[model samples]
Each structure stands twice: as C-alpha cells, then as structure tokens.
Target: MSQKQKILIAIAGPTAIGKTALAIEVARYFNTEIISADSRQFFKEMSIGTAKPNPQELAQAKHHFIDSHSIKDDFSVGNFEKQAIACLGKIFENHDVTVMVGGSGLYVNAVLYGFDELPKASDALRAQLNERLKTEGIELLQEELKNLDPDYYAEVDVYNPQRIIRALEVCLSTGKTFSSFRNKQHKERDFDIILIGLNTDRELLYSRINQRVDLMIKDGLVEEVRALQAYQHLNALKTVGYSEIFRHLNKEWTLSEAIEKLKQNTRNFAKRQITWFKKNEGIIWFEPTETQQIIDFIKEKLITTTK
Candidate 1:
C-alpha cells in the first residue's frame, strides 16, 4: 500500500471568529494535536488581550506554540516557520492528520507555503529605518510603503512599525516591491494541507470583535497591560488591545476613548485578516458554526485520498 499523506488541517479566520473552539472540536474528532499559528498567542505574557484559549479549551486538545515563548524572546515569523515545521514532524509520527489554527495569515502561510528568500536587512539599514520612524513619523513611512508596495500596505497592519520597517528595508535594499517577492516559489512540505476558512456577515463579525474586546476588558485586559508595562516596548505588545490601552495609560486618551479605540482597531484588524485570507483561493470557506459539515467535508476528502 502507498504511504498515506500526512494531512495538516489549517483552521483559519479573523479574530473573534471562534477559531479556537472550532479547532478543538476538529482536533478532537481527528484524535490528534493542534499547532497554533497565532502570533499573539505565542507569548506567555499576553493571554487576556490576545484572547488566548482558556485552560478548559487547552485541556480539550493537545496544543503547541500557545504560550511557548516569553514576551522577552525575539520570536520572528522565520523562527516560527522553523519551529512549527519541527513540531509537525513530531505530530505526524502518531497521527495521520493534525490541525493548525490561527488568525495570523503570514504565520499560517509560512507553514503551508514556505516564505520566499528576500534580501536581508543590514544593521545600518535597520538603524536608518528606525531613525526615520523616530524623526519622520509613521505617516511618511506608510506613504512610502503605499507607493512602493500598495498591495501589501492594503493588507498589512499599518500601525505596526516592525512590519512597516521590514517592508521598507526590502524596498530600499532590493529596489523591489515587498509583495512581489511573496509566493514566488513554495518549498515542498511533506504533508498535504487542507485550508478551512471561517467567515460570516461583516456586521456580525464586527459585532463579535466589539463584544470580544469588551469581554477582554472585563477580564482585566487593563490589568494585564499594566502588569506588562515594563515590557511595553516589546514588539509583541505592539498589538491592538495592548497598544490602545498603553496610550490610555500614557494619559494620551481617556479610558473610555481607549476602549472605543480598541474596539475600532480590533474591527479594523479583523477586516485586514479577511482581506489577507480571501486572497488564498485554496481555502474552503465555511460559517464559523458549521462544525459537523466541516468534519464531514474533511472525512470525504480523506476517503477520496485513501481510495
């Protein structure tokens, strides 16, 4: 008999789309483990704001990469790609199928289709970009990226200085659009990937995003931020829930205003996630509540492949 291909079921969607719950259900059905590709959930210090899986959910399925790194660790997407691949090697040992879940499109893409070999940035170049950010302001860098790589700018988190600077470094060093280098040639993975994307009406999604933020706040998102104030300068903390609250703690905005901004920013982030996931035609879209249907679809695929 031919060796059965190891299947990696990628459960992906926007924030507040119930990815974790659905991933647990699917992983349970497969009797396998899950690998989290959510960049925010990787840090041990970012539970409340990142909407990390509660202990009960984590207990339902074996999960990797959740709180696997400290906030102080310099974890990059490149590092994640390598670590996730290594984790999968171990997972495929006992199970024929494993699930990968997250809202971070870049991290998911890194595991499914390996990243392209882009030009590396030198220390001097990074320092120059950082200085530009310090003096010229983010608007200037945003405009530069918009002009150079409008496609990436459209999908990326514009408020993220690290992403913006990385794009600019590539644009300046290689004189090429950052988006142009993506998906150039995918590295071969030993496993077959099945992408399942969850989506709903825009209004419903926004509503969920707002509600999730409120719950996070009620769950002491402010206290979480306050606890990690010393690490506020960390790149991991430069996220939606934390950043808005940091501004509030800085007395730049009223607490109420910060809460509203957090909701608005989260909604915007969800929209960007949708835009990024929609570009991948390989994904099979479903409503977030379609648990049985998703399982049946996966089973059908398995049957066809096995035969």
Candidate 2:
C-alpha cells in the first residue's frame, strides 16, 4: 500500500444525510474499520436519539466508540480525541485507511485539528457555575458570552444553557477567552486525510430530521429520557431531543410543543453543522447519492499514493 491508500476518510455532513450507510459501504469495500465521531452516540443511553447504527451494520464492519459510555460518564471532546487517535492507530496496523463518520463538527475537528490545551475546570469553579446556573439562569451566562466573545456567542448553542455556562465560566474564572484555545496548528497524522462532505436540499434535510425524531419516539426515546431525568442538570443531559422533553415533564411546555421544539432544534443543529463543515477547506462536497463515484475517487487516490 502507498501513502494515498493509507488515507483517513472522514465522512461528515448535516444530520440524516445517510453518512452511516455510506461509511459502512466504503468500509466494507476497503475491508477496513470505522471510528464514529458522533459525540451524542457515545452515551450508551442515547441510542435512538443519536441514530446509532443497527446491529447488522455493526456485524458487517467493525465500529469504534458507538454506545461506548453512559450518560453518567462525563466524556469530553478532549477525551474523545485521545481515544479516537489511539483507536485509529490500532486500525492502521492492518488497513491503510479508517472511516470516521459523523455530523458533530467539534468532535470531528477534535480528531482532525486537535483540541486546545486549556486548564481543566476545578471542582469549585464547576460548583460555582452550577449554582449560578440555578439562580441566575442560562440567559445571564449567554449575555456574558455575548459580551466576552461575540464570535463564539453567535456560533455556540444558546439553547444549551450548560454549554453557555461552561464557556462563560472558563472565561470569567480563568480570565481567558474560551475560543482562544481552538483551531491551533493541525497536528501531523501518519495517514493522509480525505474529507467527504454529504449534502442535500434544506427542506428535504429538515424533513428527514423531523421523521427521525418521530422514529426515535416510537423506539422508546421518552422512556430513556425518563430514566435519565434525575440527572437532567448534567452536561450530558443538556442536549436537543431529551432537553425539550424534560421541559414537557416539568410542565413548562406541552408534550406536543416539546416534540415540535425537539424537531425544530434538531433541524437548526443540522444547519449549524453544515455551516461549520462548509468552512473547512479540506472537505470534498458530494451528494450522498454519489456513493460509487466517491468510492472510485478514493480508489484513484489510493492508486496515486502508490506512485
């Protein structure tokens, strides 16, 4: 095998764009393995909402980091960066390339660009942030982030109060901009990278997201949420689908409205993911339907690496 054959194919795009299927097919064709970059899918309790690959897909090709942890486990992007790189190192021992597919822009970049080496928050700082969150609410923190770092404020998930608080706490407690430690020099990797971006029309993509949420409900997402409701304040629990349902359970929103918001928020997330990935210069954009063409392109790239 040559340098191109040792390529790391990264499949990323908006949610529900068929990245999993494409990744599986590509992995099978190359007789290689897959490393999931989907951050939500790491929580063992979030199978349905994360759209984790079914057992058949797992049996067809080896996958790493899917349903690998519980919501109780405090997994971070930094931790994922370490584990994913280690997993890829093992996979590279046999196959030239490994497929990493997901829509989580930060997690994907955590693997590709490496995370910032910021100081870990102390327990006291966390407790302070949590207390402020309870008393002052996320709106106050959002305002602080807007004033502290307006660039990140527009890009960050405002609805996710926990993330907002964390960013602000990092700035206020440490006297450093949260975004200050991001997008540093790319760490050199052993294998070449091939970034495959999937795309579709906005209306069609939103429809897919709505339908996926409905499917999750049918697959027992509500029960999963009920089981984890006691830990709702945890950062793991402050996500799109489950957070909205928690509001309904709190009588803050009707069940119907919560479901609606879940769908709407998921759609918005997909939009943000697309915006983030489009700005990445390395990715080659393709329609999900063009699987064979992508495969052939990869094959040619591999051939070029041999020369």
| Structural similarity to truth (TM-score) of each candidate | 0.97, 0.91
Question: Which RMSD does model 2 reach against the true structure?
Answer: 2.2
**For each candidate, what is the lDDT?**
0.91, 0.85
Write one digit per residue (lDDT tens) for candidate 2, span 1-307: 7543477899999889999999999999999999999888888877776788999988999999998998788788889999998998888888888899998888899888787776577788778877887899777877888999786675666767766877876787778788786776777766788899999889988998999999988998888888888988877778888889889888899978989999998888887788878888889889989999999988887777656
Task: Report the CA-based lDDT of candidate 2 relative to the real structure.
Answer: 0.85
Give residue 240's error in model 1 in angstroms. 0.9
Candidate 1 lDDT trough over 10 residues, lowest sum: 1-10
